[model samples]
Target: MGNLVGSWRFKEPSTVEECDSTWGSDSESDEPVAEDDSGISDSVSPAESERAPGHSGDTSPQLSDSPESAPKMKRSFYAARDLYKYRHSYPNFKKSRQPNEYRNLRFYLNKIPLVPDGIYIEEILSKWRGDYDKLEHNHTYIQWLFPLREQGLNFYAHELTQDEIKEFQSTREAKRRFLAAYSLMLDFYGIKLLDKSGNVARASNWQERFQHLNESHHNYLRITRILKSLGELGYEAFKAPLVRLFLEESLCHNTLPNMQHSVLEYYVYTIRLPATRRRLLRYARKHYRPAHAFLWGPPLKRRGGGVGPEGGVGAGSSGIRAPAPTPEQQRRGEDSPSSPSASSRIIVSSHNAMMCQDLAGGGHKGYAGLGSSMVGLEGTILMAGAQRDRNEYNEIVPL
Candidate 1:
């Protein structure tokens, strides 16, 4: 067994907002930028980040065999690995050298059946791709379907390696299989990934799939894993749109209830492009309310001064209505020093409102456990059985 370090090991971002705002410089490369709606010209070239090794249309300088080029190649690899920052710190800081488990992922990518079922990548995509029931009930498939550099929930599956990542990124067959796996998961989430542009849009059954997502809290972890895996596998181009869509629907449209927190905390930082991440952060800041203050990456500053007397510049003024104070408290008046009714107004979003309705109509039968889980913090839910990283893996040994 061998341990490899330097640039490949996952490092959690110390300050997420600070990291996102400056990770990738706009002048990093001359690659075309995706124009922001607000006409921001800031762009992080794909070559500087997720552009595959042998991908066509790439203008980045190629690595050479010369000793002088070695350092440049190393720097490029390091830049590529900087695509994501884990919310939770890496699993083991004491261990200097982490395990590099690549054989299983390599064999699996090459169409060899590593799992006990003897089912390979082709069969999984062709036969079991659309099987939502099997996907949900069967836990083993996720680790293989979305291989990560870190440890996953499935102990049976192997973690990724630098070599395996290169193979998946550069080789034609492995890249195709990777995209197929991504497409399958996208369909499962009721999203359609466009073939040419790599942009994602809502699938025909988005409503149905979204409703199911609200009903179940377990998939949130899966989503977090998927985002992390995509970042690791050089699919950073695909991550931004999906995350943008999630934020738009959940925060702005209110269509995706119970998803805002997970998306904001677990999904956003996985984006490789700095400009896009900043744009989404700005949007979230603008649309989100005081209820979500705790979730913001940077310290949310008070705009137009603090909450003033006469309920000015407060929750009431910002469209978040506070519950009517008890008659006794009201009679005591706003100036009463003894009044202890300063509890932050609980924002009953449409999802919570629906939960209330379900409660009124004879208990939450189908939506069992969702209401409680939704209210819990991101760390609480993530630490409980959610596989954040695959740090534990069998090291590679030379024969």
Candidate 2:
């Protein structure tokens, strides 16, 4: 018991020098004590000497150097952070009865198993057999969407069976995911955005329809997320509405700038071409970045700016829903930038349009001021507007 340290503290000095200083004693002190990391500081005062009456001050006990007695190093944030989060969830497949929370390091080590994404998803689809009615979990569907899209395969939307489409249409959340998928399609392939008979499907008032679809706040968020994904994927299909969101703040009314930040972040960090980046940056407010900077990097410094190629929203919707916007609606949405506020936006819309037209072989030169940001796009206005009945919001937007 005499060899034991008198007391301990929570203070963890990160360096040897710091540890020495932390444990350093003044010329006259004789007590051994430590400061608590939980905000308490305590060092035995000289008046509280261990010896009674005439005992010598040099009799103080020294800290031992045994393995168990040595001060332990505290955990580092870099190493413990993820483990901390996992521990809280503490995913035990047996206890949770679900694999959703399971995150075995081995799973990460083994890898997703390299294979043709399309072929892999197709094989899964075969067994699933386009029937989502009885499936309680959608993880299989989720696994299929993300990896394939990451590989830049946007046309995967066309592969969905109608019965599978019905499964997504069954609920609002499902529809939102579906919207994300269609947005992926537009990002990679904006050409297949129409049909002749598709024109008249939205015989109802267009503006009203747009409002109704966005009545739910979640739907609005999904819409903006998809638009940002469009820019990230280098597709110009929906740049008009994308521009409108920033042009008229009212378009983003009652919602946080999540969508706005997403669009700006993509433009700032993901857009590579200087001219295209400059074009997008023109619409960005001076302090816009402080609102919600992206995870990619710090807010871009002046000298200029831009951002995306991989990772996206999800699967495209097939013919189960409404058509794209009509030419008239598109022209209205793409009206030439007349106002100062609208000019920068015009460049974006026009540039995106030019891309679509080119990709779909619309037969024309690239947009004059487009540069690389607007590269290879051909269908210009493939998507006009999306539709969903009773505010459920359909994923298959026109374009």
lDDT of each residue in 317-393, candidate 1, tens digit only: 12212234467646764666543433522333222323343444533342333333233343233323222321211
The residue ranges of model 1 lying beyond 4 angstroms of the native Cα positions read 1-101, 104-110, 114-116, 290-294, 300-399
| Local lDDT at 359 for model 1 | 41
Per-model TM values vs. the true structure: 0.54, 0.22
- Maximum-lDDT candidate: 1
Candidate 2 RMSD to the real structure: 30.5
Give the per-residue Cα lDDT of candidate 1 at 5.
36
What shift in Å separates residue 320 of candidate 1 from its native position after superposition?
A: 16
Cα deviation in Å at residue 181, candidate 2? 5.4
Cα misplacement distance, residue 278 of candidate 1 (Å): 1.2
Model 1 accuracy (lDDT, Cα) = 0.50
Count of clashing pairs, candidate 1: 4
